[model samples]
Each structure stands twice: as structure tokens, then as C-alpha cells.
Target: MHNHGAVGLPLGFTLLRLILLGAVTVVAGWALVRPFVPAASGLLTRRVVTGFAGIGGVVVLLIAEATWMPSLAAVALIGLLAVPPALRGARPVLGKLVVAAAVLVTAAAGAWFSGPPSSFAYITLMAAFVGVSWLALCPPTAMVRVVGAALGVTLLAGLGQVTIAGQLTTPATGDPLLTRVALGPSPVDVLVVPHMPGWNIVHTTDTPLSVGNAPNALVPALPRDGTTGRWALVWLPEGRGELWLDRAGTRTTVPVDPGKVAWTGPDVRGPEGPDYASAVLAAKLTGKRGDLPWPALTDADAEALRGQVAAIGGPFTVLTDDSRRAAEAAEVVREEAARRGYAVTPGTSEVLVLGGTPPSGARHHLAPWLVPPDLTTPEARRYARTLSAAFPGAAPSRSGLAAWAG
Candidate 1:
């Protein structure tokens, strides 16, 4: 079973966490109880300190997670220890509750204000805070008990269950209470041609591809330097071909008998091995290989984009509905246009791009490439109409004006 985010913690982070934890203990111990002499008196009074500690724990953890500072979260837990003693000097219960409520209010102030963090980080930090605060309370023995309990709970949480003899003591089940998800896979996309069968694998690189004039860029098939001979695969849906193998810089083409094939170079295998799943194959030869040409843009699409660019520089009055997001997007359009020799500048024709929200309410899922605001002015209406003409799918809005933002 693949437990999500079960990846081991990096050693550097682990060491840093230990140091932070030690600091929390020291701070909490020193700030709370100054040892010897007037020992912690009035157990009831000490209990009130717990309430203040709770308030500090919640607020500090929230702030730490929002900022991705785990060390700060640890410091916050230690600071909470001090908070209890400070509040204990007064009517602690009422004060603690007031502070806790204030913390909740602060958290609800939305992304613009409260800068939300990963829910898991927030939860973990809060748990650590609670444990440290508990340890800071009562006698010195409380540290041992609280720390042990905290470690056990944290370990079990990381493992996703309490197990006995490799079997779960408590049945594993999804909980509605746990809203935080673990770290997830990176964002990526690839095209898979359906019905085109055989061995399928995709390779990609982040290196920017150098493109040139025309609608496509041609890249020569130069095999990267690394010797382990290269193999060529040849066949189509109507399967009729063979496999060719090369070593070092020599070229050798051997006709494959149906499935029977053999290769020995980087892979040490005796004789021919059967390659049953290969629709089409080509190998990159040393200095002798085909050039790869990719369509940068279709002629029609290029013309349409060019036209759009030309429109931007002249009679277009671009109105960014959101100065924060749409303002940048509008600028991108202008830059791309300028790069293609369209050179758009601000003008009288009103073109408004509504960002942050679309008619569908989801700014991400359902919006098109571009979203124009409701056509109120004549210039906006004209711009929308032009877009509709340019893009057939760009049907006008209720007021019969078309605008798009992708």
C-alpha cells in the first residue's frame, strides 16, 4: 500500500526540528517555573495557565503554518508556556477565552489577510504546541509523560494507524474530521493517443526548445553522448519490420524475424529477444539520424493570432477588471503581440477582461482562454463582436458582446 506523503523526512529538517524542540522545552521550563523556592502553588491557579497556553498555541501555530516556518511554530509552542504564567497573574479563564476567539477571527480573514497554509502543516504544528504546552504544565515528571505520549501519537499519525504485529489494532478508515491531505504529486500533463497501442512512454525536459521562422521548428536527431549502442524500432499498425542495433559509432541494420530479436551492448543479453510490443520505432544514430520537426503553430492559428495582435495595438482599449491578476494577463497579451510585430498599445476601443471570477463562478475550471466583462459601452461591444468574428466559438454574451480570457 502506497501511503501518501510517507516519504522519509530529510535529515537536515529532522536535525533542525530536534533543535527547535529542545529550545521549546528550555524556554517553556525557564519561563514557566524558575525552579526551587516558591514552587508552583495553587493547582487551580496553575490550571488557569493552561487556558492561556491554549490560546497562544492556536494563534502561533496558525501563523507558523501560514508562513511555512516549522521552527517558528516550535518557538510559538515555547512562547505559549510563558503566556500561561503571564495570564495567571490576572483572571486567566476569561482572558484566555477572549484571546482564543480573537485568534479564530484572525484566521478567518481570507487569503488576502490570513495567508492560508497547508492544512496538514497547521494541524501538525498545533498538535506539537498542545503537547509542549502540556509538558510545560504541572511537575517535572509531566515532561516525560507528555513528551512520550506526544511522540507516540505523532509516530502513529505518520504511519496512518496503530499497528500490532503488522496488522492494524484499530481499523483504518477515512475520517471526516481530518481535512488535511498529505503532500501530493507534482503537476504535469502529457498527451496519450488513444487506440495507438504498443510500448508507450513519454520523455520530456524543461529546457526551452529553440524555435525559428515558419510554423514549425526542426531539431536534428543527435544522440546525446553516452555509449551503450542505440536500437531502431520500425513498424506501423500493419506490422512489418525488424530491429537494428549499433555499437559505438558503427551502423548495423539486422532484419528482425517477426518477434525474434537479439541485442547486446549496454544490456547484456544473449542472442535475439522477442520484442512483441512495438507499433513504430526509430533509433538515434551517431551523426546519422533523422531531424525532428514540430509544428509551432498552424498557418490558420498564426494568422488568427496575428490579427488579434494587430487589433490590440490599434483601436483596443484594454480594461483589466482585476489590476492584480488581469493587469498582468493583459500585459502578456500586449508583449506577445509586440513580439510578433503586432505592437499593441492602449487605445479607445474598450476591452475588459473579468478575472478572479467568471459567469460559472469558478475562475479555474470553466472559464475560457479569455473572459470579457459584460459589454456595457459601445467600444466594449465592438471589441466583443470582433472577438466573436475571430473565434467562431466565442459567442456573444446576453448583451451580444463577445470577449475571451484564457
Candidate 2:
């Protein structure tokens, strides 16, 4: 059975398809027009070809399909495709003049549009004129064959040019994340923002951060040193700085009250998730690794801190709230140390306890009964007792815990 749940079109695939279809439309036009022109009457042929092309365009528009405009343009090209074949035997001199005039007019219009490579509509018009003029002006000179070849070449060039132009005109989904530049007294401080390469697949929401016009550029600027997979700048809070994370899920704006937060910037910045995602993916593909761990919470370096804790042994204090998870873990460690013959103090607010001094040349191991400064006397003492009970050999005291620290 076909699983509908698993069926989906990837964004990259969809985009590539659109591009290919656009190319196809331009390429196919010449072929469609070539065949019908040789057998049809001149006026009837032109009218029929142009009429069909116009109808095809209208149909594409009416359908409002994904590639409607491209489809229409392709259809319209078919008429131009026929110009050389149909004009081969016509009044050579007149056809040449007409074709030349058409070409000149199209060139003027193309200049007005400033088309890339050359403007699409104007290029197509010129291609048609060139083919027709060649056929009409040089009848004895393999006119049909020569103009037909020119038509094919011209259409191919026009197709390629238009395809590129379409690409340029279309909003880009994958581009490098632009580093936001902040003017500094000495030199511009440009913060490298992490761009998640494949993030555009999921997080499609475009906020001001995406547009680079966000008022709070900092919210989008995170100190990305490269370690963790690239981060996408999702939010930029002016003055407050920016927030970034890997783009994999949906994100909602934290709606702070209008008065609680201020928006100040050159312009309202829109979301930049797609661009950032693309960059990160590209970086990952290239095997580029960065130096810094991201977001700071799940830092790989945090593991190093664990070693420092292990070396300090029993005397190192742990202050915890009522949850007691930290305190409980400490008791387990202290018990393990005692079995190994290390002298350590384990303290909570209720009791200040001391174990025998460590072995000669041993690191200090003292557990002090410590609680947050603001805890009530009784609550502090209760916590101390909890740890003291866990450490039967040591004396737990509230003040000892406080004094143990430098």
C-alpha cells in the first residue's frame, strides 16, 4: 500500500523542478512552431501560431498553475519559432524590411527592460525577426535551412538567458547569512551568525531577522565560534542582543508587552531563517568545524567542569534548593570517597560537619553545611541535617559551610 503520510516534496526538489520547467518552456517553443509553419498559409499560419500561443498563455494563466507564466511564455515562443520557415518563399525584400523593423523595435523595448543576457520578450522578438529576415532576404542561399538553424540557436540562447533571468528575479531561498556589521570606534565589529543549511525545510516563517532590517540586530547576532552545528539567527533584540538556535522546529515570537520592550533600528527586520539555514547546511557539507560550542547550556566544555568536581572530593560544597537533587548526588559522591578513605566534610544548613583531615599530601575534602544566603535559619538547618545524615562521619554546621568558601 502507498503510504500517504510519507509522501512529500522537498523544498529543494520543488525549486529545482520549477527552474527546469521554466527552461523547458523556452526550449520547446521553437520546436512546436517549426513543424506547422512549412505547410500553412502565411497569414493563416502567423495567426494560427500566434493565436495558439496566446491561447496557451491564457490557459496557463487561467489555470494559475505553479509554472503558469513560464508555460505561457513557452507557448508564445512557438509562434516566433515558425517565422523562418513561413517566410522562406514570401516577398523576400518586404519580409526582410518587416523583419528588420520588428527586430529594431524589439531591441529598443529590450533596452528599456534591461533584460539579463538580453530581455526575454525582446530576445524572443529579435530571434523571430532574425529568422524571418534571413529566410526572406536570402531565398537562393539555402534560406529555409539557414534561418531554421538560426531559429534553433536563437531559441536555445534565449531559453538559457531567460532561465537565468528567472533565477535572478526569483527570491533566493539559499544565500549566505549576511554578517551584521556594528560600527566600533576602532574598526567594525562584525558578528558571525550561524546559518543552518537545511533549516529552510522546516522553519519557513520569515521574521524581521530574516530580512536584515530587524531593529534589534543583536537578537539575531550570537557569538558563533563554530563548534556546534551552525545556528540560525532567529530573533534580534536591539540593545538586548540576539537569540540564535539551530533551525529544525517551529518558533513563536515571545510577545512581550509593547511598553516592556522597545523596537529601534534602521528598519523593521524580517525573519532570516531560510538564509541562515542554507549557510549552516553548506558549511556542514564542507566539513567545516567551528571553535565555540553553541547556546552555552549544552556545551561540550561543561564536561570538563565535571572533572574539577571529581578532584575536589568531599570538602567541595553543594548548595541546593528543596529539590535536593544536587544534595543527593553530592551525598553519593561523598559516600564513594569515604569508602576510598578520603576525609571530607558533607554539610547542609541544619548541621556543620567535619570529617577527619585528609591523608598526607591529599587534596582538601571538606563538606560545609551551606544554603543560599536568603534561606530561613530553620530551613537552612533542615538541609544541613539531610546532608549530615547522609554523611554519618562528618559534623554538619550552617556557619562552617559559609566560612569554608574563600
Candidate 3:
């Protein structure tokens, strides 16, 4: 999914370009080959070369799944070349069937393996061969004319249905689902800010920089205008509202209301005291505010937050994916928690089983890396065996064990 250097083209546009280019090339090639076919009827060179070219084109199409070779121009060229073999005089019976079967099979195999884009591109090639074969094999009579007319009508109907279906299924421009996670070609410069106490908000580029992902995550370049040190207050999942409040001397919690505007006090003791400024931020930033009103919190809310932090004892642990960092973070959290009368044990095991579910009031968010069970490797397997022997059934999950040690 993370194709670092992947290039993309709209599926319909790519197919159109392929067909237009192929038509031009095919027309030009036919003009050159028409006169020579009569004079060189017995030569094997033309047959051999055409067969090789057709086979090579099929191979190229299959490989295009992982590579961008035989660009649109090449596809047109090969499709154009196929027209001649298809038009070569009337065949007895078996020879015609063999050619038709081979071409169909080759085209199908190439299309199936070439990813959706390439598969669609080769449809034109298939159509060209089928049409040319029918024209060459049948006599210029009423039956052939009737069959062609029927096929044309059927194709037009099918095309009309497909077009209508496409329009209906397509989302409008502003629809959220149609938009990708972030805008533009460049990756968003995410600033994750987890609600870690005392730590000056850790910043990382890892995506989904919302709650449970980053520590005090901020929007990229929000402080360009130094006059106002503006930081967007974000609401975490489970109706949790957070703000970065640092006043000149007296910093106090902004009363966030789920039904009204969130109140934040200005730095000075003068005018901006109780007349707080508030607005409805993004839902992801404000949890689910649509059903509720704003001025989002009350004094009771501040008391509730205090109680939650008190129950947690203090300080959230931050564990990075790196073993060295996790180990270091674990040591810090363990020491700090123990000092605050909460028992703490830290280990680099594949699994962690806390004695109870995280306390409701506790702001106890584990570092991102610690959320998932670690995998066990040879070194890990040895460690897990020792740990499990000491504490039975304390081993990591089976999948994690396999991924870690395998």
C-alpha cells in the first residue's frame, strides 16, 4: 500500500490515450504493410517477427503491475501491429480457431496479471483482433452486415449503462469520503501532542496525529505570527477537551462546555478576564459537538479533570517503538509512579497485563509503541521462555511471538 515511488493516472484517461495513440499507429503501419503482403506472402519472416512481438507485448503488460514500462505509446504501437495478423486472408478452419484462441488467451493472461489499469488498456487490443478476424474470415454478405450492426448497437448500450453507473457512484467534490486523509502531493507535517504532564509536548511526523497518537500535537506552522501564540484547543475521544493555557503569570483551566463556547482567560488581569473567546473547531478536534452546544466546559469539568489526574497518580508514560527508548521510558514511568504510591513494574516482554482496566479518572495513556503487543524473535523467544517460566502464561500473543521471533 505504501508504494514510495508510485505514479498514478486516471483509469479512464489512460485508456483513452492508449486507444487514440494505437489508432494512429495502426493506421500508419497498415499503409506500409498493405502492398508488401501480396509480394511476400510465402515468407516466414513476417509471421515469425509478428508472433515474437505479440508475445513480448503480453509479457510486458504482465510486468507493468510493478513497473511503468511500455508507456502509452508502446501499447498503441503493439495494438496497431496486431491489426495485420488479424487481417491476413481467410483461414481454412483449425488455423483460424488456433490463432483466435492463442490471441484471446494471451490477452486475457496479460490483462489479468497487469493490475486494473493495464487490464483495461489491453481491452482495446482484444477488440481490435476480434473485429479484424471477423471481417477477414466472413464473406462480404448480408449475414456479416447484420451481425456487425447488432454488435454495434449492443456495444453502445453497454457503454451508455457504464457511463450512467459511473456518474451515479461518483461522489461530489466536497464530500468528505472523496477527499484523502491529507491534501496535496506532499505528506502533511503532522505534530502529535499526547496529553503528557510535565513533558513539553512531544512532536512527531507519524500520521493520524490526533489523540492517542501524538503528545500535544499542533498544526504545522501555527505560530508564524508571534503576536498571538495561537494553539488550537483539541477535544480528545470520549468527550475530553484539552487546551494549552499559559498566561503571563496566572494560567487557569478554560471552562470547556459541551453545550456552549469554551472559555479561555487572556494573560492580563484587565479586560480579557471572564469574556472568553470561543468557536466550534473541527469535530475530530472537538469529539462529537454536532449533537451538543458549545462554550463546551464548566467549573465542574475542571474538577473532574483534576480528579482523573489524581486517580492516575501522575505523569503519563511515553514508550517509543524502539526497545532502547521503551526501556528507558518504562524506567522513568516506573520510578515516578512508585514515588507517588502507585506500584509499578516495567519489562520488555511481548505482552503486558495490567492488574485492572485503566482507571476512569486516570489520564494513563501508554506510549504509542506499547499499545500493540511486541513480536518475539530468537532473542525475544529466549527472553519470553525465561519470563513465562518465572511467571506462567505471561508470554506474548502467538501472532506477536511469531512476528517477533520468526
lDDT (C-alpha, whole model) for all candidates: 0.31, 0.33, 0.32
- How many Å off is the CA of 16 in candidate 3? 8.1
Which one is best on TM-score?
2
Worst 10-residue lDDT window for candidate 1 reads 171-180
Regions of candidate 2 where Cα sits further than 4 Å from its true position: 1-38, 41-48, 51-145, 161-279, 282-296, 299-301, 306-406
Clashes of each: 15, 49, 29
lDDT of 2: 0.33
Query: How would you encode candidate 3's per-residue C-alpha lDDT over 44-78 as one tens digit per residue?
Result: 43343344334434433332332323355345535
Q: Write the residue-wise lDDT of candidate 2 on 1-406 in tens digits.
A: 1112222223443454454344334434543345445542355444433343333332322222222124344343444443544443434454654555474444445343322222343345334434443343332334454455555565455445534423212211122122212122211112223221211112222222321212222233222221112223333322111122212222111111111122221111222222223233333223332111211112222333344345654344333322232344445555655665555443422221122223333333233221123335675465455433332222333332332221
TM-score of structure candidate 2: 0.30
Clashes of 3: 29
Off by over 4 Å in 1: 1-12, 19-65, 68-82, 85-95, 108-117, 127-406
Cα RMSD (angstroms) for every candidate in the order listed: 25.7, 19.6, 21.8
> Who wins the lDDT comparison?
2
